[model samples]
Target: CTIGFGSKAKNIVNEDMVLAKVLRSQGAIPLVKGNLSLGCLSYHSSNIIWGEAKNPWNHDRSCGGSSGGDAGILAAGLAPFSIGGDLVGSLRVPGAFCGVIGYLPTPARNSVIGCLFPTETDTLNSE
Candidate 1:
């Protein structure tokens, strides 16, 4: 799964986020980890990764961010599904670039109480 925050950040696991918790309750297994832009801070760059996540279709191109890693894994057939957080297009951009289905619910439609950085309050205007 592609975690939306940096690995060093607090509460970076799926269990810490409400959406992931719900998914886990429904029988989802996180098999692979994907890289993301630092602190969900950059959408145009993937430089924060240990090794940047490249597009599955074209290794020279970006897989998109901050959820780029999730999209990359999905495109590479490493994961059946992935959960990603988006403030602008973290989920959508990566999915589009990777040629997979990506969904971003309205801010009010889901709970983001435990998501790292860019908390629900931080993105109150995004909806």
Candidate 2:
């Protein structure tokens, strides 16, 4: 799996993210990083590095943003599941566009220990 270059990912972090660790424990091995919005904020999936993420159902349609790659990959049957940050429908929009399940867990149920959300924002507002 190839990951897109989202701005947040540019920050150097040697350790795996908390989500990655949790997934690994369940026997999920992340193959590679997937595409994402430029700044992790966009309704479209286009980026300079990997280009635009298109809907599998229709080439011309958008697969949605930020998590578009995740939805695109899932829609294409590449992976069973994927993790994406959702702030302003980043995950749900793509999931809906791609005709997949986009679940937003309650803030208290999920952890954001290794995430790099904007400092001024509340992690609870995201999924």
| Maximum-lDDT candidate | 2
lDDT tens digits by residue: candidate 2, 7-96: 434656678767778789999988655577777778788887788888899999998887798898999999888876666788888999
Model 2 TM: 0.81
lDDT of 1 at 66: 81
Identify the runs in model 2 with alpha carbons over 4 angstroms from their true place. Answer: 1-12, 118-127
In order, what lDDT does every prediction score? Answer: 0.70, 0.74
Could you tell me which residue pairs clash in candidate 1? none
lDDT tens digits, residue span 1-127, model 1: 2343345545434445676677788988768667887656676436433558888899999988887888989999988888766667788889898999778755566665565544653332223
**After aligning candidate 2 to the native by TM-score, how far in Å is the CA of 48 from where it should be?**
1.0
Query: How many angstroms is residue 106 displaced in model 1 relative to the true structure, after the best TM-score fit?
Result: 2.7
TM-score of each: 0.74, 0.81
- TM-score for predicted model 1 compared with the true structure: 0.74
Error of 2 at 73 (Å): 0.2
